[model samples]
Target: MHAGRDASDTLAALLADWQRARTPYRADAHDELAAVLVLAGSNADVERLNLAARAIRRQAGELTGPDRLYRLPGGRTLALAVGDHVRIRTNDYRARKSKGARADVLNGYRGTVVAIEADRSVIVQWRRPGADGPALATEKVSAVYIAVGGLSHGTAMTVAAAQGLTADRMLVYGMGLDPHTPYAAMTRDRLSAHLYLPRNVLESDADRARHSAPRNGAEELHRALNAYAAILQGDRADQLISPEPEPIAAVRARQREAAEQAEVQKMAQAVFAAAMLETVTDPRRPHGLLGDDQLQERISAAAAQTTALAKVVEVEQRRERQQAEQVTAVRAQVHAELAGERDRLATALTALDDAAHRHDAAQDRLRTAQRKVTALEATLHERYGGRIRGWLPSGERARLTEQLQQAKEKLTCAARRAEAAGRAEQAALRQAVEVFPAAPSAAELHQRLRVLANPRTFASALEKESAARVEAVLPGLADQRRVRAARMASPGLGDSAADRQHRARQALAALTAEADYRHRLDATRQRGEERARRDPAAPALARSRHEQAQQQAETRRRAREQQRGYRPSTPPGITAEGPRQGYGR
Candidate 1:
């Protein structure tokens, strides 16, 4: 199915099916789950097949990169680039690892060239256990001598080279071929396979003598195909039963030994077998057979067998019954124990999943905390290199800065409220002294504030009121914020100074994040549009340096928290020196 093989009579139908099957193949073949195999018989045939495949692949636009090529073992020059798959042909722990992390880039290990650092060395990534970090392990393998013998071509390989390899689909070229080697080559595909053989007609004398000469073209093809099929069916590596032809003397010796063994067994069991046969035989069934008394006498004489055989049978049957009971008991015990074990295992798996989730969350928090600590330490070092030099440690400076911002906000809110209150008090005092209209109601105040907040929408009406002096009822309009927040707990004026400072910091951070998000959104839009226009290649395999799925999960978790109105508390403390005790620091 992967090769789009279907029952078709016409060439067009066959080609159409192949087109669909080969829809999403890459020029580099990196996007393919498995490499296309062009199996051939000889080295020259292999080269020819490779040439044909290369010609067809290049029509799809070859991937361009720095002209760096490595000659593999067998004169195959493979060009290494990002996204090309490779398998380790040799065990190479002697080579230096990338980023000081050792990976088992041993023989038969498969990986993709995530990065080509140099002509001799490339960074290969091994798959991780989960979807979260698919490509987790990397190793930098380089040539110790001439070519990097560890790195080899993975897209196409010879039968000897493909010993332990597996693939998705295979194309077999069985011309001038023996089926012996192809046994290993053909079964490598897990999905689909095909065999293309050059028809071998019985034109030569030896072949014509062995096989029939066809009378017609169809008959010729039929004979050739039948011969090829017989060749394939007959030369199976496993079914080949060729021990060296036995020497005549050795064969005679074996035959004599087998005859002697048979004679010994026959002699050993002769008496008992004869007695048993005689005891079971009845000769009185036919009219001319022996009479009842004679038959009884003969039977009695035969039945004069020892009781030892009866004892042996009884003992064996008893032992078998006992063994059967024991087996039944054991089976019941095993079933009971297995049920309990399965329950325990299920419980353990559930607990393991929960533990894994908790571990992941803790790791994320640890990373966030570490980043914050690093930033704080950097600021501290920048401010105060030593104890005697600077006035504040990083934590102390941040605390003071936060306090200052809160203080300024509180001052502004208080001033606005005091001004508004003073104006109100003065108006009240003037009202007591002189005749004045009743004070405006709370609803009236709210309406006025709402108008002031969006003056454009009610601009003409408010302006007309102002022109007519109708706005002079109350002293000055309170701030457009809610009446309680405006007069009492405004931006930085909260239940406590610390609370207000935290709110201010949260607001500032939110604003900063929003601005950054807006910039990134625009960039993301442009990138997405451009990417949509780009040709589909190895995007499925060559994801970003880090997995986007992990980031997406983190984003989703944060979004859920935001939807629930969950706010994070300040992270724990760190200083330029190191982390300090939260109890005392």
Candidate 2:
């Protein structure tokens, strides 16, 4: 037994040496398995070497990379790499008999393949089909395992026969009774308690012992060859056979530190050389009068000057700080004062604007009133005119027509006198008379008279009337007609013919000679009332002092607004210190 063991050891060593010396079939398969083991054992180099050996034995194949394909039982095809292990199954039928019991048939069992398929399907041959039959005919059947290259005819049947034995029988009589198989089954939780029965109750141990004996003929031969092949390939070799060397990180670190130290020493030498060169080339002699004593004296003087300059600078800085504070305080006060002034001015400006608006509104109202008066005069003229009188109310039309007829008679008598003077005078008189024909009513006559008295001729008419010239006579005659209109409008006046004539003459004089006749008329009436306060014999004023005061206030408000002063605040761009803050700190 010892010699046989030595021979087996020698054979294993030779096989390992031969496997190591063999040429690789696929370079890509070698690389892939090397990479997988290297990654799987990153922590320890020794573990990596062991893993590499296992990967080489486990993954050796004729095909490279993942080029090979394997079809699984579920009808799905998968791309396979050299090291990929897969399960293959084939059906096996067997016939067996027990003493005084009917024979039984088993069918379609499972097994692992040793090599690739030789045909489209694994050829499964049945041993027997009936309870009482002899050994069955060897008929090849199609299945997943096929009749692969390395397996023999009866080798598959022998593996199937091993599944019938009890645990003790398998241990005593099996060709390879691996105790690790039960441990492995237990580790995987697949060992059933029923398979481990007591020896006396069922003779299970004896039966298994008889059944576990090694097979004869081709089955034994095929298993021997498979075992020999596995040993040659180093597939089941011991794990602690190879070891790896330690990493070189510490040596690399020392080399890097030494290089850094050398660089630092070189830099130090260059600095020392530069210092020695500077010392030799320096212009100032160390022992010269200007070098030691004079330099010391200069340094002392410089120190004293620095002290004095520092004091001066300190004083200037203090002054500047005080000035800055004062400037800040003044700026704050100025800002407050400016703010107050701005607010006050804004309020005053608002008030001024309101007053100006009120003044404009009052002027607009006065203009509107004048326009309304002009339109009323035009309407009255149309109502009083002979043909256009049809547009007016019957009562007002009759009254206006009577007044117009009287005014036309007076104008005709004045025109005839002017005609007796001369042809040129008559022509002028006739032209004036044409403006004063027999108007349809009194309002029409008043409109014609207003048109004839051109507002632009105020100065010339006043000059002529003051001198009692003949040119003013025509204007004076129109004035007398207006005086009669006023007297007729008054409700409670009963005077003698001479008094009425005198009042009429006074009104004509007021109209012809005054430059601002309307203003003079108002003033004269006021003066007459004042006089009548003492004499009780004159008319009252035409306009009130309240109306005059309101007009004067409105005019003053408009003038103030025109002279108003207001300015908006300064924008961001143009300031005292420029726009430097936008760029710098």
Cα lDDT of candidate 1 equals: 0.47
lDDT of 2 by residue, 383-502 (tens): 665765556468775665565565555555545544443444334333333433454433453444443344445334343333343223233533544565666786345443444445
lDDT for each residue of candidate 1 in 1-585, tens digit (9 for 90 to 100):
111111111111222223334555653343353455444566444443333333223222242355367765534455565655566677766436545356555675555667666456777765534466445567777755227466654434556656666667666555446658767767988777665443332133466676554566565556555656677676423345556555865676567545644543333233222222222221211111233345455444434322334455567568657655654555555445434443444444344444445555555555555555556556656666677757544577777456555555555555555555555544443432222123143233334334444537445544454433322432322222244364365644434333444444454454444334334544533343234324243232224313555577789999998878854455557989988555411
| TM-scores, one per candidate | 0.30, 0.20
The global C-alpha lDDT for each of the candidates, from Candidate 1 onward, is 0.47, 0.36
Q: Determine which window of 10 residues in candidate 2 has minimal summed lDDT.
A: 34-43
Write out the backbone clash pairs for model 2.
Answer: 122-146, 169-209, 384-440, 384-441, 400-441, 400-442
Among these predicted structures, which one has the highest lDDT?
Answer: 1
The residue ranges of model 2 lying beyond 4 angstroms of the native Cα positions read 1-291, 385-394, 397-585
